[model samples]
Target: MTMDGKVALVTGGSRGLGMRMVTAFAALGADVIIASRKLENCEKLAQFVGEEYGRKALPVACNVSDWEQCDALVAAAYAEFGRVDVLVNNAGLSPLYPSLDQVGEGLWDKVIGINLKGPFRLSSLIGTRMAAGDGGSIINISSMAAIRPAPEHLPYAAAKAGLNALTEGLAQAFGPTVRVNGIQCGAFLTDISEAWTPEVVEVLTRDVALGRCGEPDEVVGAAVYFATEASSFATGATLRLDGGVR
Candidate 1:
């Protein structure tokens, strides 16, 4: 897939799957906007993409949990690139706790706000412009937890399920010009993988068709398919990327 002169904006592009996608987009010849909570990390990725891929990269500090920040992130992307052809809502938060009883209002709120509300605002804002202008694509990053929730990750799973719903709704809302889709991701060795113990890993892969966690770069192909003309006829679809785990 050749993006040639396109502009791509990715949330949570500072590290893990987000960072890998950012790199893949740049390599495909698209100018990239990498947004995350930390300016330092974003800037580091932006510089590396520019130097290595020779594609323009902008690092913007954004905390998607805040509505104001989401607005600012949209404004900044449009201001710098004039337009964004691809928008990836990949930022997420799933903090670990010892027990479900320990889950608090704050934790639930933060997880839901960032995972669900953030994408809704960003896609509504960007997809509107995309439909009006030259058109674009929006990809929401979901998780398997949305379909099969474990007791430990109930909040995160609920939020991801909301994200899947948002993807379908936005696809209808932004039809013809802007396409909306989702990637229901499974376990991958991202930043959150540090918490996975041997026992946890064994259990996760036991019934999985692929029998292992995914690599960060493995997600890039699905993202590219959604971003480019390849998936022009496909909208409101959610593709699972979780190593075929149910």
Candidate 2:
């Protein structure tokens, strides 16, 4: 799991699980590129990483949902660190809707663009460079809703299902040099969880074998595993980090 002398680029790295991953990689001796829509947040985290871990952190403002911004992000990372040894596609969103029929096209496109399209573009660009170079790892952060779709998150679920497929397909496309994998997360008490209704939270907590939602830091182990040689034998696999959701 040692990342000394490596560079990691993480989307949504300003906070939540992404933030934890950025800091973890830094602690392991990897310089980081933190990309998010909020430049201020990214800058703050970057400063913290430099002071706390003595690792270089580059703050880039990017909305992964846009293809142009994704392109710029890749370019910026490479320009800063020369190469990205690890890429974590952790940016995603699932907006609440009152009814299925009320789910408009804008919402659908936004969900798909962020959860599926963004990862695809980033993986294709970065994975190609990684393959051409010394090799790298790409980790897509998916959701349990991908397999167990509900009325509340149908669009989001569909997007994540596509992300799962993307992970497998990309692993094959960039294999032998670059590896791609996914983490199908269950309910986690991140900023997003604050939006979950009480009933929704209760049901998810009851369903999980652990009888509770996961903390943001709990994702560090899986994130580290996929990012380093710890998961060298794993690729095209989606590890369930749902606390044994049944």
TM-score of each prediction: 0.98, 0.98
Residue 222 accuracy (lDDT) in model 1: 98
lDDT digits (tens) for residues 132-163 of candidate 2 = 99999999999999999999899999999999
Write candidate 1's Cα lDDT for 1-246 as tens digits.
Answer: 789999999999999999999999899899999999999999999999989999999899998989999999999998998999999999999898889989989998999999998998999899999999999999999999999999989999999999999999999999989999999998898878897799999988887898999988899999999989999899999999999896
Q: What local distance difference test score does each model get?
A: 0.93, 0.95
**After superposing candidate 1, which stretches have Cα over 4 Å from the reference?**
none
Please give the distance, in angstroms, between residue 143's alpha carbon in candidate 2 and its true position after superposition. Answer: 0.4
Error of 1 at 150 (Å): 1.2
Clash tally for model 1: 0
Worst ten-residue run, lDDT, model 1? 187-196
Clashing pairs in 1: none
